[model samples]
Target: MTITEYIQQRRMALAEQLLMTTQLEIKEVAIAVGYTSHSRFSSLF
Candidate 1:
């Protein structure tokens, strides 16, 4: 996959984990997924 596709897949996987396994805030999850902004992550997720 392209880097964009790879990152997107990872982001989705992170989103699922964030939704399923923890109480961490969205901003933290976004950063972990390599996005600096939760809004950007929210848009994609």
Candidate 2:
């Protein structure tokens, strides 16, 4: 995979882990994964 794709995959994996392992809000998790828009992150999720 390209570097961009790899990075996105890793971000998604980490987002999933944060969602599963923590009580952080969606927006917080999105920010932690480098997303600035919660709606966009929700769509990606």
Best by lDDT: 2
Error of 2 at 42 (Å): 1.2
Provide the lDDT at 38 for model 2.
95
Whole-model Cα lDDT of every candidate shown, in order: 0.85, 0.96
Off by over 4 Å in 2: none
Clashing pairs in 1: none
Model 1, span 1-45: residue lDDT tens: 899899799888977888689887888888877888889889988
List model 2 lDDT by residue over 1-45, tens digit each.
999989989999999999999999999999999999999999988
